[model samples]
Target chain A: MSLEIEVFATLNGIPDEAINNKTVIVIDVLRATTTITVALAAGCLEVIPVLTPEEAIEMRERLGDERVLLGGERNALKIPGFDLGNSPLEYTTEIVAGKRLIITTTNGTRAIRRAAGGRLVFLGAMINAPAVAGLAATAATDITIICAGTRDRFSLEDFLTAGLLVDQLAGQGEFVLRDGALAARDYYYCHRADPAAALKASFHGRLLADLGMEADVEFCSRVGATDVVPVYGGGIIKKAS
Target chain B: MSLEIEVFATLNGIPDEAINNKTVIVIDVLRATTTITVALAAGCLEVIPVLTPEEAIEMRERLGDERVLLGGERNALKIPGFDLGNSPLEYTTEIVAGKRLIITTTNGTRAIRRAAGGRLVFLGAMINAPAVAGLAATAATDITIICAGTRDRFSLEDFLTAGLLVDQLAGQGEFVLRDGALAARDYYYCHRADPAAALKASFHGRLLADLGMEADVEFCSRVGATDVVPVYGGGIIKKAS
Candidate 1:
């Protein structure tokens, strides 16, 4: 079987063919994937991704707000009246444990929805790179890694996370890599020694830092920090059992 | 001042915003840019790029057959009755010197047309990377390097060529790089010691080799082999004087 690393530089860049019959790993390391991994690890029962804030709120109402927490962000800030912003730190055990999260985001959720037709969809980040790669290697079909770039443009953080995953997947078994995969692997090697430094220099990283979220970049760059692989199916994400 | 390397994995991947108000360098190093650079270096007066074979034939008819030569390929093979195939070797001084050529191809010309709104457009390849970078550094606006990916899919060769150009441009001036540019530069550094080896392993390169075009890949991988920078303006490409 072949492994194709198809990076959608932005949510809008994903091609229709990428979402069909493939094992898709969606990454938005700047926050979304990081947030999901942390939430699941903190014992959140499930995370439902919606494209819009209204949809997130509606889902929360349907599930009963007492049992569901509204989460997500717009323009890198928490949505008004929502329970959480996109930061991974916000999904603490005290707040998220034992509850369901109805989430929407500026980029990541849109990308996840776009990959809804995949045979298997998983949320990946540096935090869960090895775990995702291990699961991905056993897939019965081709694997595609899609990056949730920032604001419909290329985001360095997402591509770097993809590179880390590609590197891990390559080590697990032999597979034919697409050009994008090769490129991502090469990029990962270039920054493998110092991912935080690489992230600090990225376009989105700098933007986030300017917004006083530099700690998030440092947190997101910690490879293999969590073993949680959040699998998405039937409209919700839950830690794979 | 900034230099952005916007890599479109395929022609279909280019964003609408990437084509405006920038100095765009279009690279299709597998053959088109290599051929165009060679044609100009061997003394072709001008090369006009069109999206279809019929457009090339019509342009030749309008300009008279004696003054215009039809040159291009549909599937790495010459169109029947055309003056030349899409090979740099076919653009010898004896046949094409001082003549105008109308060219079309499966990928490159379409990418060129896509960048038509740019303040300046130039054809780039490994053969003319330094030359293109030198010219691009002088642009009053930002420089955007666009990879004409293979047949609506990402091609390894084009991205590597873009990386080479980004590396060259980075050395010549102070410029902020976009995430795509950073990825390209890092990729180039990973394989800078052996570009031909990297190209030979690419999907398109292997396909071309199977078709007995191994020599073309070797020729196209030669960095700084030519000084010709083919500038596109008024819908025609000519060696920048």
Candidate 2:
């Protein structure tokens, strides 16, 4: 029997039963997962994914503010009084290295939390797509790619990232692609040539451009730019050691 | 300003604000909407979409069952005690003509009801896509295409049907394609040549084929085969007059 893969454009409407026994790849390409990938690659100790900005603040208080940094966004702008925003480029090695990162966003963190039933949950984005897919393929018999769509709506950027991962994963071995996977795989095939253009065309991507964060979109658009696959367990995400 | 178009793979997360003042096109190509279009074209008096088989039966009882037909499916099979299943082939002129269809399905009917806030609601499928799009473009300044996804998950056939509608609507006039519309439009572009193949590859399509309904899939795959655009108003759907 071949492996089975399902892709979800958003986390809404997914039943709890769908996640059990499957390995999940959570994506929020513009730019929660992308930012997390960058933070981990830059040597951040770990990422604490909370659902809301208020929760992020509370977590920071409990963790103590010394070596921890808060990062997130609402409406594509940095949260007030946070260490950083959702832009991936802000997590340079010098800025995030050796720090504990607590992150939340308008959509990504909630999606990560809701995908908790999966036996294994790995954060995947265009930046670490190839490596994430390579690692995830061997993790379980079933794989679910859950895209953190913008504000509970299907975001094109995340769906496209799923397509990218599906395309790469298809090369590994034979697999049964479910409806969402088939759609994303085909969409990825259609838009794979110009990932950056695809991102720039997305709703969040255009919003980011309007906010002068095109650099973030460009940074998140580079497929396989890094090989860091952040795994989540017990509400914490860390680089696979 | 040009028209605005947004396509939803499923009706789950659509906000009421999104539907306000927009013409909505509800699609369920395999085969709720397809069946409705066929029944209407065959001269069914009207299609009253209810949420459940029980509701369909109740509605039939309330209406005195005279010249009334109950049609629906559960898990793509005929609902028990219903006069007909969801297969478009069964909704022939000989069977449905002059009858009132109290119709229900697992997903399609709920989608049609949920789009109640729309300024105008039109059912569009591959069978009558071109005419629906042409008429819908003139009915309102904004259009929202809602796909009745299979069991609250993204259904490839519905998405493809939405893509086909988006593609046809694009040709009718200039429009600003939102994220969902852009994704559907691109998906349609990828698989426009052979829709039957697309349908066969979907989760529900394969199930119907397994249940000996390959002919139904082929029947729904033919684009622009009819000009019957069913419009829903005042809780009843009838051929556009």
Candidate 3:
């Protein structure tokens, strides 16, 4: 039998088979995925995802500070001594051009590290979701979408973004939707009327608002603004080749 | 912040929050949930879900067989000396009428036992998707959907059914879909066009076919055939009053 695609809402929800020998698409739409997608689209060379802050520091040391820039966030705050934070706004072309960024984050990067074996792609609101789904549709292996929710809990922004992506994929021929995919699509449908409002209402969004980052939430919710799909391969994420 | 409703593709994936103070809907469309729904809908008085066949036998002794019936399955076969298997077909009106069933199955029943704390509702393809969603939507507590996947792995059938159910709950206001919920919904959309073919292509379906039970696969795919929503309360499932 051919491989069947499966969608998992969280890393914890992913089954052994969904991870084993499968192509996984990881989404952290509130910030990380969106940030990375924008950074790459804005002409960043590559992003090396590190599991721990210490690892990012070590990578920066090995790669040399002249060529490598440090980028990460802990609890959505910029790490001390880092060149940039986890916001897409901070990853503009003027700063990230021709730079290799060593990045770490609380949830999204950890998920990327855990997903070392699978064929991993990073999706954001900027990318045309249909393009990402099209890439998944052509892959011979089973597809697993892992949403990097906030701190071991479900994040609404990520779920809705994943749903929008899944909704696009479901429109393709002969594809079967699983419960996780259906949940994502339905969630997208539920929030499709007002994505900015949905993002603002999220737990992370409220935290960001408390931290005075309401503009970032609005920016992240704007869909299809960019057409870049950053696929994670080797040890870094680059614009999908 | 209000408690968010998180769904899990399997019992093992349930977060502490979703496992506690939540009204969990456990679904095993390949049969446990479907069979229980069919059994109770067919007129069975009550269904006691136990973790093991041994536990089921012990309860049978205490409850007495005057009205109780031992029911279970292992590897899709009837447990030795049990009155019924995990087959919706066996739960016909004539056989299950007014009887009490003690069930312990491989995947579905075990998931129900592990999901002990919540107000558990057993769901199957038989129930109307809207009704399952309505119960979750109107519940006083947060909702968790525990899909009884095959042997702790992601089973397409259970997840697709969960997606169908979760889709109904979306857009009810003041609700957020978790990663598990998103994934299930994505799965549902992917499979909605041709559910039977989707079921036939699942890992469990292939195994069932190897065992020469392809009929069971087709039988389980029929939606909304039963209206019963078997609520697991007081450690037993009965038609919710």
Question: Which window of ten consecutive residues has the lowest lDDT sum in model 3 chain B?
Answer: B120-129
In candidate 2, which residue ranges exceed 4 Å CA deviation?
none
Clashing pairs in 2: none
* Model 3 vs truth, CA RMSD: 5.2
lDDT of 3 at B82: 92
lDDT of 3 by residue, A1-241 (tens): 5545455655664555677667788888778888888888888999988888888998888876687888889988999988899988999889998888888888888777666678655554524566677777777666777877776565767777777777776666465666456546665787778878878877788889899999889888877777788888777888887
Measured against the true two-chain complex, the DockQ scores of the candidates, in the order shown, are 0.55, 0.80, 0.18
Q: TM per model?
A: 0.95, 0.98, 0.73
On TM-score, the stronger of 1 and 3 is 1
lDDT on C-alpha atoms for all candidate structures? 0.85, 0.90, 0.75
Docking model 1 quality class: medium
Q: How many clashes in each structure?
A: 0, 0, 31
CAPRI category for model 3 = incorrect
Q: lDDT by residue for model 2 over A58-160, one digit each (tens)?
A: 9889977699999999888999999999999899999999999999898999989988888999999998999999998887568899988877577999999
User: Which digits, one per residue and each the tens of the lDDT, describe model 1 over residues B187-237?
Assistant: 889999999999999888898899998998999999999999999988999
Candidate 1 TM-score, C-alpha based? 0.95
Clashing pairs in 1: none
Error of 1 at B183 (Å): 1.2
Candidate 2: what is its chain A TM-score?
0.97
Answer with 2 or 3, whichever has the higher TM-score. Answer: 2
